[model samples]
Target: MKRSTKITMVVSAAVVTGLLVLALPAMIGATTWVTGVFGAGSGSPAATEPPNPTADPASDDGLVDLGDGISVPAGGPGECTSTAHISTMSTRTDDSGPYYSKLIGDLVDRGPSELASGQALTDEAGGVYAYEVAAGDSAIAIGERFCIDYITVQSHNHVRAGMIHAGNILYLRPDPTLPWVSPYEPFDVQPGEQTGPYYDAIDFMRNAVVAQDLAEAQRVWAGLGPHIHPDARTIATRALEAGDWELLRQMFP
Candidate 1:
């Protein structure tokens, strides 16, 4: 996993944790509007610190491709809820009891989780990308790698000082001119195409995981065949993306 992505994962854990602990009912709203800049408005930098360098990557951690050359760190069944394997879900279960309702109501058409996993991250500062720093990396090096300038890397990533180290996650601001997709309207490839969910297998994967119905999730994949990436994939990849669809508080809260 790249350092930037790992940072996103860690930050997500922290933000979501804090959101649950401190905001509870407000979490849905907080995450939902946290990054309007990428979606519909401008996002100003907050006085935030980067992720701690002390943590180590989970052995099972890997990357989930979110299209547009954007990827986020993901985990195995235990770490990620992206896959269709119920066995990997954390031992944590709702004290109320197992959530056994159909993922989606009476919709053999889709899983509840699929219906619930919600939208994508097509909105935002145009569209942004997160970059992970490697060992021995420097600002200039990062700039060169992405074809951005060193000054912009420092400013965009909020690197006020200190050397770039391994495990540092950097948020790359997008060039506003470039076109990006919207999570809610991902099927805009042409004037009237609605096959994205069907073609990309998003509806298939999301419904399975959100429903926690691995069997059904797997079943859908079996039908997708080569259209799906070998990694399969996750509908949720970043914090803003998670918030846009209320996936965080609902899925893990």
Candidate 2:
């Protein structure tokens, strides 16, 4: 009886060993799958990492394209504020004359007191001032009040001709010595059919000069090489080389 019991026990132990051997491979495979899912353990499937995103090339150089060949520094001028009293009126000019003619005529018609009364809140350095558009305010009238040319006001504020509305804030007297920075929206000027790309090119050149980016100004001039007149291109090239921002602004029609 003792001998038979020993044989049965031996057989049972051998069967148990065989079952463990058979289950070993499956246990290892399950462990490997878990490791792979958790991104751990050697020989596990390599985890696929997400690809890093690339930055905009223009942004790296701190430039933002404003379309129509105009590009400015990425971040514009700092916040501006003022507390100066602004006078409001309801004056409107006759639409009979040409736009430019009316603009000039209105400036001439304003008396000294009216001109003097057009005041703005000035900065500490007196290089810039904030002026609020009053009722019946025209670009030329605002320019006259601020003692600057209408074109300067228009270009600086990015105001379209005859588009000034009451309560619009305009920053005036940008320090020419400092780099050009505008808080206003980019000026959108389409090339006139008769004028060709002259206006667009001029606008770009003006912005480049105001930003004091000579290389960009030269690039703009070169891009317009084939379209603009030879004399105009020559003058523009000279102005760019001389760093003449005022000349570029004056080039506007």
* Top TM-score model: 2
Per-residue accuracy of model 1 over 1-253 as CA lDDT, tens digit each: 3222222232223122221221111111112323343355333322222222223443343544434323334431122223110000111232111111001000010101211221112223223233445556665544433333344334323343535555444434332221111112222234465755653454444445445564565566455433322211232233223333332212221
Q: Per-residue lDDT of 1-253 in model 2, one digit per residue for the tens?
A: 2212221232223132221211111111111222222345422112122122223345564554433222234444211121111111111232111111101111111222332333343332222234556666676556554343555455445455547666555545332211122212112213433443554665676566667787887788676655543444455566566655544443421
User: Can you give the lDDT of residue 139 in candidate 2?
Assistant: 68
**TM-score for each candidate, following the candidate numbering:** 0.24, 0.30
Per-model C-alpha RMSD: 20.9, 37.3
- What lDDT does model 2 reach? 0.37
Which 10-residue window of candidate 1 scores lowest in summed lDDT? 100-109
Clashes of 2: 0
